[model samples]
Target: MTTALTLTAAPGPDGVIVLTAAGEIDMSNAEAFAEALTSAVTGATGSRLIVDLTEVHYLDSAGLAALFAQADQIELRTGPLLAPLLEVSGLAELTTVHQA
Candidate 1:
């Protein structure tokens, strides 16, 4: 099993990119994950950002907020942020209904 949460990012066709994260996200690594998302969004423009959390088995409020913050960052950059996929296995109560 993967010992650490792996955050992988790759650009898709038409400037669209997917940031795929797996494993557990909590306070310890939340900031790093958030920074990663922030960097990804900041590095690109006028593209669609899709964060795929299908492999993410667990999450917390910090993680959820970090993800949403990425969405906001993308939008502020004029990048079209796609609907996030929180997957089926994981669950979290967040102000962002789009997450649920």
Candidate 2:
């Protein structure tokens, strides 16, 4: 079983679902993380998602794939994925970059 991920939801000024997650994202917990993120973005009305990975210390292919997949869905909603780590250093250096 994957370790439980923490998700905090607070209403933004524009009523966007601001979910904060802090922990390692890998095969062990990617599914849960993906579910929470996907649901929050898809259900939110603003169609904006800001994933803060500043606290994530580790990530695996599964985690990367999950993020990539979520990014794909967000594109249709005109929502862009804002990732701090994925930006400073692209996920390509890591494994399963083809997913991106």
Candidate 3:
């Protein structure tokens, strides 16, 4: 069964576009995540995009790849649980990862 993922976009300080994501981001829902992220970036009126993953409980390789695909166009805000994974996976080098 496919897991459900929720994504929301809003404007942030300093002309940043923030895309907030919640729920599991596994293979089942990676495409949805990617689409949402793409839409957020493309629809953004700001120069920078910030993806907030504080509410995301899980993210698999597919989800990581989706994020990586857009790393150059976005920054990431993640909780402690996912911070190390992003760092170890070298995604941290492609984009800024803010730990909360």
lDDT of each: 0.60, 0.57, 0.91
Expressed as tens digits, the lDDT of each residue in 2-55 for candidate 3 is 997898898887768899999999999899899999898898745889999999
Off by over 4 Å in 1: 1-3, 73-100
Task: lDDT for model 3, please.
Answer: 0.91
Which is superior by TM-score, 2 or 3? 3
Which residue pairs show collisions in model 1? none
RMSD of each: 7.5, 7.5, 1.3
Residue 38 CA displacement from its true place in model 2, Å: 1.4
Candidate no. 3 TM-score = 0.92
What is the full ranking by lDDT, best candidate first? 3, 1, 2
- Which runs in model 2 stand beyond 4 Å of their true positions? 72-100
Top candidate (lDDT): 3
Q: How would you encode candidate 2's per-residue C-alpha lDDT over 23-97 as one tens digit per residue?
A: 677788888888977887777755565555545667667876776776643321111242444544454233222
Of the two candidates 2 and 3, the one with more favorable lDDT, higher being better, is 3
Ranking by TM-score: 3, 1, 2
